[model samples]
Target: MAFDTKLKQWTSLGLGTVLMTGALAGCGEATKPADTPAAAEVSETEANSHAGGDHHGAEADAAAPATEAGEGEGGVTIEAAYTDPVVYKSAIAIAAAHVLAARDAYAEGKTEAAAEMFAHPVSEVLFDMEPVFASQGVEDFTGLFSDTSAAVFAGESQEQINARTDEILAALDKAAESAPETDMSDAMVSASVASDQIERASDMYVLSIDSDFYETYLDGYGFYKAAELTFSQNEAAIEAENANAASAIRSALALLAEAYPTALRPDSLDADASALAVAASEVQLELSQ
Candidate 1:
């Protein structure tokens, strides 16, 4: 599950760059400076056609000095760069940088701080639904009590859930103490942190289930509706929460580590990174279910 969450965050954050870049074209922010090579590659003939009289007539009246002066500049001037296909700008690059930085923090064991990098939109989605899931019993959610749900509640029993969770914590303590002496580079660290963020969402599943709760409260739709509220309020967070199932994943990883510290071998986090990306996509899908 942690694998899934981490993969999802990475994937969504990655794809978000594309979506944001595309959207930014409408706002005229995705365009880079005229001097930038990305902008320079545009053929003047093609550019001139795009910067035709009709397009500039309205802007000519209200054009700022910079816009007016730049109009005559040659080889894809910034003012003339506004039409059609949007180019990648520094803003998209900056967003990518932040995500990379956050991921670095996590891999280095700065778990608390690393969490701050979580996409807020995803957080909002999960925050709204989590409380409701905790409050409602499975019994009330007959429509939702199925294979997927069962897997989600795999270790919900009092004896197994708490016990297994405790084991994982203990293992993490050991890992922190025994981790290899290699220094983590910025990129490696960021990827690892992102992995942890997605992995943490499992907590919701662990805490929400109770054997008896399922007997009396069985309205899956009601619980699902609560999740929907979460998505509406904060889609990003909800996505993260759902993908990582951090609580449950951490517990499971910890328990597995206790038995065999290398069970999931997160030390080599490439696999985990990919999984985190996928988990994010799944989280979005799960909310609909």
Candidate 2:
């Protein structure tokens, strides 16, 4: 859990810095540069005018018809509103997949991969749920969803992830209650199934690590192939006296070790034909530098 703790600490520090910077920048007298006072004043005046214009423009756009103003402009679609139930259900399913994939990635120490998986449902899938929220009179569910998603991407513990997932499901249930026409049964079931999968996968993956299951399991064959290809490339670089290429290859090998630490050690690199071929292609791209 060192990585998780470090990630959370980093996120807290980063968010604090961003907020503090914004606060300082917002304070007119505090933020002014000594040499640029006059220019800053002019810029601030123009910025205020632009902000006012933007506020009015936003109001005007909100008042406009959904089809004319919102749809086709990267805004929420009319379909999203009418199809709230289906969209909400689909988003839940996607979120579930993301949770499982992120947990798996994290277990394997693929921090960046885990972060990417953790972020997708929030940025893409959950954002699509805004229409559903509006339809249900759920005012500004964005903050809650965004915060939870941020926590997940910041490497919150699996317990926190589960709790947040439950929170989301509860919110969805509340929204469904207000919008009585939208059946939430399927969405709820899908969410439950996904949550169960994550729990089971977490246990199984942990046990596998302890038992060296990944190395013994046939599915892990690709990992060995990847390591061998990387090692071979590293050997060639060393033979050619290309220190830089060899160093890069060594870095790639290190990444592979982080990815499959237990089962795919560099010395014992062997895999079945199909898995070896696929792993070769992937490792080639991974170590292309």
Candidate 3:
């Protein structure tokens, strides 16, 4: 799918979340709490069941930017990127970022948010990765998602879900080893994943600018969260390999952080849509170099 088309699909999917949250918040929304790290995690995470992952998937035939943009054998996770190992690994990393965010939501007493985080990837990313997993000769870690999500759905404690998070993330790491042979450094691959997330954040942010629904803002925030997490995790590697790229990502994330301060919709755009797009573009340029 083209980027524009995927953005439309994201908006459509986020509408469902607006409805779901209206039910969840009820009178509780009367409370005016400051952002608790991920205060809007529940609403935003749910809003992005398909939005976050499919940006990387639009490359069902390719991972490149819609006009721009994976590969492993069995079946190409991304047709255009079949030979590029990083795109495959980056795809897996994006899903892990979502799961990681869920763990945080769980620790912060946001079980519903945590559950949505765990559950979305099952529908949004797993099936898409099957072909690449097979091609890479990695064991199918699909069950990890089910096992972890079931724990969340079962009302498991944060510690228990954390254990499950460990399992799912580890399995994803193992699966990432399947990308076809390549010369790219691991840091470069991580940077690519960050770039993908940024691209998605920019896309979702675009939707929020003209929409009335809070979920559109949440959709963008989810991807921004993912991008932030990915960059921080890989900071050492990214910096070691290319300080300029690391700085580029850091700056872009700073702008995004200001723009998406929380999952709740703001009365107006905090960061101009063009600014967000420029930040994403700059970061992509740094990584591409």
Give per-model TM-scores. 0.16, 0.33, 0.66
Residue-level lDDT tens digits of model 2 in 1-289: 2323422442334321322221111111112222221111112122223210001122222332333322312122335544555333333443444444444545565443333343333333344344555565664443344455456446678677657655754554455445424454443322222222222222222223333322222112222222233235236434354444344445434443343444222343332333323333343343333
Candidate 2: list runs displaced more than 4 Å: 1-84, 144-156, 172-289
Best by TM-score: 3
Model 3 lDDT on a 0 to 1 scale: 0.58
**Collision pairs in model 3:** 59-62, 61-79, 64-69, 65-69, 70-81, 70-82, 71-81, 71-82
Reference-based lDDT, each prediction: 0.25, 0.35, 0.58
- Lowest-lDDT window of 10 residues in candidate 3? 22-31
**Where's the lowest-lDDT run of ten residues in candidate 2?**
21-30
Candidate maximizing lDDT: 3
Q: How many pairs of residues in model 1 come into backbone collision?
A: 52
For residue 167, give model 2's deviation from the true position in Å: 3.4
**Alpha-carbon deviation at 214 in model 3, angstroms:** 5.5
Ranking by lDDT: 3, 2, 1
Report the Cα lDDT for residue 1, model 2. 27
